[model samples]
Target: MLTPVLIVLGSYFIGGVPVAYLTGWLLRGVDIRRYGSGNVGASNVWQSISRAAVVPVGLAEIGQGLLGIVIAKAVDQGLAVQVLAGLAALAGHNWSPFLRLTGGRGVGHAIGFLLILSWPGLGAFVGLSLLGVALRAIPQFVGLGIAVAPLAALAKGQSLEIVAGSAGMAALIIAKRLLGNRLALPPGADPRRVLLNRLLYDRDTHEREAWVRRGQDE
Candidate 1:
C-alpha cells in the first residue's frame, strides 16, 4: 500500500522533470508554453525547437514510465505496481515539475505505460490509434475515435487495469483536442469547432450543457 502511494508520487515527481521545457529553452531560448500549442509536451517542444528535438522529447516521455516501473518493481512486481505506475505516469505528464508545474497531455507517456504493463492493451491502443488517424483525416470525425476506443475496450472484457488506463488515456486525448480549437482564419468561428471543443473539453459536461442552454434561452 505504501509502495503504491510512493510509486504514484515518485512517478509524478519524475514525470514533472520537464524535459521539453529544458530542450525548448536551451535550443530556442523560448518557453514552449509561449508558443504553438502552449504545452510543455513533446509536440510543443518539437514545434518550438528543431524537428530533431522530438527524438529526445519522445525518449523523455518513455523514460518517465520506465522509471515508474523500475520504482514499482523495486518494491514488488504485480498487477498493482503496474497500475499504480501507469497512473503516476499520467499524473507526471499532466503536472510536470521543471516548468512551473505544467506539462503535456500524456499520450506518449501512456503509450510507454501500455507497452510495459499490457501488450494486449498496447495492441488495442495501436489499432485505435490507427483508426483515430484515419477517422480524423476527414476533420469532422477528429475526436470521435477517442470516444470509440473505450467502448471497444469495454466490449473486449479487458482487465480493470487496462480499462482504467484506457479510459484515462481516452479522457486526456479528448480533452487535448478540445482545447486546441484554433481557427486558421477568423471571420467567424466554426460552430462545429466550437461545439466539439465544448463537448470534449468540458470537464463538467452537464454544467457546460446547462450553460449553453442558458445562453441559447437568453
Candidate 2:
C-alpha cells in the first residue's frame, strides 16, 4: 500500500541524514569519513573524535529507526515498516548524501531498525552482537548477527516480510563492506591476529584503534 511505500521512503530519507558526518564536521571541522575507516558511523566517530559523543550519535540513529516503526504501525500491523525501515537505515548509513555518499557499515543503524520493529528481535540481535563482539568483534560477526535477525523474528512468530527484510538488510551490510574497498585478510593471515582484532575492537584506545582501522583500510 501507499503507507508501506511512504514509510519505507521516509525511513530511508531519515536514515540518510548522516548524523555522524554532520556531527563530526560541526564539532571537529573534519569529515570523519576521510579520517578513519572511511566510515561516517559511530565507531569511526568514537575512534577519531570524542568517545563521549558516541552515545548521542547512536541514540540519534536509533531514534530515526523508531520513527520509521511509528509511521509503519500507523499504517498496518506486520513487519513491513520495521523491515523497510531497517533496509532504509542501512541504505542511509552506507550511502549517505551528507557525507558525499561515503559512510560507515551501518551496523548501528540496522540495530536501530530492529529495535523499533520488534523489541524481542532487538534483544536477540543485541545479545548476539555483544556476544560476537565480546568473543571476537570482527565486522563479519556484525554482519552475521544481522543475518540472525530473521531467525530471531521467526522465533518470535514474526511475519515473512520482516524476516526477509531483516535478512536482506544483513546481506546489504556484508555487501557494503566488501564493495567499500575494506581490506580482506589474506588466506594466510594469522588466525590469532584476526581473533585478537575482533575481541579488542570494542575497547582499544583512540591511538591504538588506528591499528585496527589500518587492517580494514588495507
Candidate 3:
C-alpha cells in the first residue's frame, strides 16, 4: 500500500515538472505564463519561443505522462494502480502545484498516457485531432478526439479500467480547457461568451493571432 501511494505521489511530481515553463525561462528568460496564450505548455513554447524549443518541451511533457505509467508497471502494481498513476500524472500536468495550480491543456500528457494505456485510442484521438487542425477547427477536433477516445478503447476491447482511465483523461483535458489559466475576462466581455469561447476555441477570443500575440504586446 505504501509503495502504491508513493508511486502515485512520485508520478504527480514527475508530471508537475513544468517543462515548458523551465524551457521559456532558460531559453528566453521570461515566464511562459505571461506569453503565448498564457499557457505553460508546448504550444506556448512554440509560439512564445523558438520552434526548435517545442521539440524538447513537447517530448518532456509526454514523457512525464509516460514515465508515471512506466513506473507503476515496473512495480507490477496491477492495472488499477497503473491507471491511477496515469490519471495522477494528467492531473498533475493540468494543475501543477509548482505553478500555483496553473498548467497546460494536457494534450501532450494525454497523448503519452493514452499511448501506454491504449495505442489504438491514442491513434483515434490523434487522427481526429489532426483532422480538425487540418480543417482549421482545432478545438472542435480536439474535443471530438477526446470524446471518442473511450469508445475507441472499448472497441479495442480494452479493460474497463483502461476505458475509465481514457474517460478520466478526457475529463481532465475538458476541465482545464474550461477553467483555462483563470485569467479574468476582458473588460465588457460577457462571462457566458468568454467561457463558451474557452470551451470551444481554447481562447477568450476567436482571433488566434491576436490571442497568441497578446503577451508580446503587453
**Would you estimate the TM-scores of all the predictions?**
0.70, 0.76, 0.96
Ranking by TM-score: 3, 2, 1
lDDT of 1 at 57: 88
Local distance difference test, each candidate: 0.62, 0.68, 0.88
Instruction: Write candidate 3's Cα lDDT for 81-125 as tens digits.
Output: 888888888889889989999999888889899989898789999
Inter-residue clash pairs, candidate 1: 16-96, 16-97
Between 1 and 3, whose lDDT is larger?
3
lDDT of 1 by residue, 1-218 (tens): 54677777877788767777788779878766655545567766655566898987888787886678766776676666666776677676676655544577666776677677556556666676676567643222324444554555667786776677667766765564455323242237565766554455432132333422321232
Which parts of model 3 are misplaced by more than 4 Å?
none
Q: Ten consecutive residues with minimal summed lDDT in candidate 2?
A: 198-207
> RMSD for each model, in Å, please?
8.5, 5.4, 1.3
**Which 10 residues in a row give candidate 3 its minimum summed lDDT?**
1-10
Full-model lDDT, candidate 1? 0.62
Q: TM-score for model 3?
A: 0.96
**Model 1 / residue 35 / CA error / Å:** 1.3
